[model samples]
Target: MKDVPVYTKSQLALRNGQDKPQIWIAFKGVIYDVTDSRLWKNGKHYEHWAGQDLTLELKDAPHSSSVFERFKVIGILG
Candidate 1:
């Protein structure tokens, strides 16, 4: 598998929850999965995962690459 691209804070907002389970992020023109991170916290900034009740807080607690590395994608939208 190839390394997922990185996205800045702005590019990610454009594609947030756009009828797709995934979207391409461009931090430095590279694409990656912002969903893979656990920085989204329910009732705070974002909602929780479907199967999970824990809200993600990327601002307060940025998601670690080691934890979300498995969810990385090349150029696909879920």
Candidate 2:
């Protein structure tokens, strides 16, 4: 398998769509690109924002982590 790149929180912060036009969010140390997701348009999904870890926020979400499976894996948090 190909090695996934690792990205820092600050680096992830820049991909929030508003900052770099690539909306991304991290979960369980894995980053997924959500730029094309209508739910994530403008980097805001409900009250959650992109470019940050959402591990702790999932419990409040209506869906499971598998919801991220549709997006591309951008990197792993470091």
Candidate 3:
């Protein structure tokens, strides 16, 4: 398998739709590309925003973290 990329919080922030068209969210150190996800349009999902770690926030979400497994794994947060 290829090595997964690593990104810092500042680096991930640049991918936010407001700063850039790409949308990224991190959970448990894994970053997912949610740019194509209808739910993440404009980098906002309910109270969550792209380019930030959602590890702690998932507890408040209705769905489990498995929901993110379907999305593309872009990198890991370092």
Candidate 4:
């Protein structure tokens, strides 16, 4: 089996949203759901992934290469 790659916060930011089912996002080796996470403003990260929103984010989190390898398109709220 191939090992999953990790990504940084800034790296994951590149693929905020796309038409894909899930986009992997790694923070400290732990992946998160960024699909429904708000990316419009700063300091609101916690609020977006506090409840059901996390489920969406987790579902969208990528499972392929790291952000450095390719761009994982995700959904961003306006």
Candidate 5:
């Protein structure tokens, strides 16, 4: 199996849609690119923002972790 890359929070911060156009979010130590997700346009989904870990915040969300099934796993958060 190919080893996935690990990124630091500082490096991840730059990927916010506004800062670098990547629009990424982290959950359970996994980073996902949400740039093409309509719900994540401008890096804001409801009250959630991109370029940060959403591990705890997602618990109150209307959906479950399954919502991440379709998004690609870009890396692991370090």
Candidate 6:
């Protein structure tokens, strides 16, 4: 199988809509495209934002990481 592309935090930041146009977030080092989700509109999710590692934040979320399964895996966070 092919390996996922790894992205740095700085590189991921460009997808925050403010910087570019896409919205991406990392959870447990795996990056997911949240662009199509209404929850991620404008690259912001409540107090969280795109281009971030959400592993630690998930603890406070109502849902688990499985929620990310619906979204596409764009890459990995390095």
C-alpha lDDT of all candidate models, in order: 0.39, 0.93, 0.92, 0.38, 0.92, 0.89
What's model 3's TM-score?
0.95
For residue 49, model 4's alpha carbon misses the true position, in angstroms, by: 8.1
Rank the models by TM-score, top first: 2, 5, 3, 6, 1, 4
Q: At residue 57, what lDDT does model 3 achieve?
A: 92
Q: Which stretches of candidate 3 lie over 4 Å from their true place?
A: none
- Across 1-78, the per-residue lDDT of candidate 1 in tens digits comes to 254444444444444445345443432233345564555322122433322212233334456434444544444221
Which stretches of candidate 2 lie above 4 Å from their native place? none
* Candidate with maximal lDDT: 2
- For candidate 2, lDDT tens digit of each residue in 1-78? 159999999999999889899999999999999999999999999999998999999999989998988999998999
RMSD for each of the candidates: 8.5, 1.1, 1.2, 11.7, 1.1, 1.2
What C-alpha lDDT, on a 0 to 100 scale, does residue 45 get in candidate 2? 94
* Model 4 accuracy (lDDT, Cα): 0.38
Scored against the true structure, residue 43 in model 2 reaches a CA lDDT of 92
Candidate with more favorable, higher TM-score: 4 or 6: 6
Candidates ranked by lDDT, best first? 2, 5, 3, 6, 1, 4
Write candidate 3's Cα lDDT for 12-77 as tens digits.
999999998999999999889999999999999999989999999999999998898799999899
Error of 4 at 53 (Å): 12
TM-score to true structure, per model: 0.31, 0.95, 0.95, 0.27, 0.95, 0.92
Better of 1 and 2 by TM-score: 2
lDDT of 5 by residue, 34-57 (tens): 999999999899988899999999
CA shift of 26, model 3, Å: 0.1
